[model samples]
Target: MTDIPNIPFVDLASQQNRIRADIDKAMARVLDHGRYVMGPEVAELEAELSKFCGAKHSIGCSSGTDALAMVLMAKNLRAGQVIFCPSFTFVATAEVVAWLGAKVCFVDVEPDTFNMDPKALKAAIETAKANGEDLAGIIVVDLFGLPADYVSILKIAEENDLWLMSDAAQSFGARYHNAPIGTNGIATATSFFPAKPLGAYGDGGAMFTDDDELAEDLRSILFHGKGTSQYDNVRIGMTGRLDTMQAAVLLEKLKIFDSEIVERQKVADRYTSGLSDIVTCPHVPEGCQSVWAQYTTRLPQGLDRDALQAQLKDKGIPTAVYYAKPLHRQDAYKHNLIAGQTSDGVLPVTDALSLDVLSLPMHPYLSDDTQDYIIEHIRGAISDLS
Candidate 1:
């Protein structure tokens, strides 16, 4: 058999090559200024982010985790309080809640969208109240770049008197009901990790909000809870500020983020057209647009996902699983409460998805031929296995 050439899971090099000159200039400017910590570039990047997302304020932070932690800190999330989050997502969504000494109530996700199910959220809230738990808020994750069902989730939050925070780490450039992702909830947090849709050269993140007071609280929390001056310690905080050099790189990347989102959609469309017959392609609800951070699909039932990934690997194609185990099933969260749980546990959809989800090579620079190759191999492997 002829060996297939290796394909990059994410073609960051191509993106960097295109913007290397601008990135270099941006970095050089930061170097010349010598204000690496909370420098002028950080503010400039925050302003651009606000302009891009239509949010009234954007605060740059050290990472997506910090962005979320800062918001919870600003909200004064306390011990014994419960925050509901989907089980079928990265750990960071629930990790921040746990960090605040609060309980994380695991919620099931919609199988098709891989986002939080509003019904599950409502049931969770009711169960928590019945159990005499202090229900605080909800953190909805935009898994794999598609925004959660915000219309329904927002209504749930309002009726329950719980605040909503969007974990847009994977869906920063996405839209929900024609509104940007960052504008949906009380505050939205997004990462600039190199693998994300709008990734930077290194770790960085931002928080977006329309509430003036909440915005001020976030700024204070990220800066060690400073009051009138740096010496004045008002509230407890952490070192969550985004570095100036990372902000500089992100500023350049933001210039072409929209265009890159368009390109990413093209790649996703091609993948769906080629592989939809064999696998369950991602579903973007009407009036919503995904950034295609990871072109994930659900593999056929009764098929071994690990075996399929190994087959692809042999052909020089790489694959990844977003979450192999739901948060409810993980060791650290085993004791955490799950929504709608009776004697038997719930979160059936979340459990099922953790076993079958597969992420393909996804990025804006994926060429048609490369995508077609991936599509053909995936289809062929599934056929042979069947």
Candidate 2:
């Protein structure tokens, strides 16, 4: 197909151009060091991340999935223990639990925010208690770069004696009540996956914690459970080390992370301003700051998502569905389903969200010219639907 004013879903190149020299220098320095695995770059990146998160420890790991698995193993939430998470989240949130033999109890999400609903979470806990099940922990995700209601979630965790872990994968650069997500949870995990707000060039992730002993326990798990020595294994663990090359790329990216976040917000503002009349714009709760990792919008009633996406594609405006299926309906996880008392046809919020929501091109360098054309085409499409 000829380029009909084509725009990429993520314009990494435009952002790269601004920091090309610095990025090259950082990589060249790593090449000269000759320490590819667990090199100085790894430690340097960890230190920088810890500083950014305002935490005492930031243990780097191979990927976001590994970062989550490391925390699940560190805490040792035993098998048969029920963990509450939103069914509307990415699979990794529930995958780690199933991998460790723990049961994931799917909770409904808030309609506006598309995050774990505190009310539904409380009801799930109550239902589990009523049925005589052991509840272990709650993993609240900062979905789409916006932190969930941490204050309420934390209060509930304390009351139930359940460990709280913040899955800040999308929300790593976001803020809640002027404080970062890592500081709120007992320990938080974030992904530097290439699409995240503060993403690296490749797979990398980190765990943030305040407790001294807890931090050490997690570090041990990431390095094969060695007790201060590579050969000394005291407990079961996994090989989850973040690559030195990935860390090198992230260290350079971190220098401008704050600026990138600012620009992302600007781009989000422009997107919503242009498209709100044609669709239901994303809701970033008051007192929360989203990194705008995805500028998603809901199609107004009576508009078909497929038709709109097809129209945009034809017009060179790319859009994507973050998820077309909620976790409960996924074939791989059907056997492990632990949804609370409800009809199979229900889970209204998660179900409707699966159909109506679609994400537009979003990144720091989405030029106004491109965005304008994209929004204009969308308005034309919605009008056509009307």
Encode model 1's per-residue lDDT on 1-386: one tens digit a residue.
57686889998999999999999999999989899999999989988998889999999999999999999999999987999999889888888887888888888899899999999998888888888888889999999999898889999999999999999999999988887889888999999999998888889999999999999989888888989866788899889999999999999999999999999999999999998889999999999899998999999998988889999999889999989977777777655554444233488898888889999999998889888888888998999887
Q: Write model 2 residue lDDT over 18-98, tens digit each, in one string.
A: 889988988898899878889999999989988887888989998888888888898887888888888888999999998
Residue pairs clashing in model 2 are none
Q: After superposition, which runs of candidate 1 have C-alpha atoms over 4 Å from their true positions?
A: 1-3, 335-345
The Cα local distance difference test for each model comes to 0.90, 0.86
TM-scores for all candidates? 0.97, 0.97
Off by over 4 Å in 2: 1-3, 339-342
For model 1, state the Cα shift of residue 20 in Å. 0.6
The lDDT leader among the candidates is 1
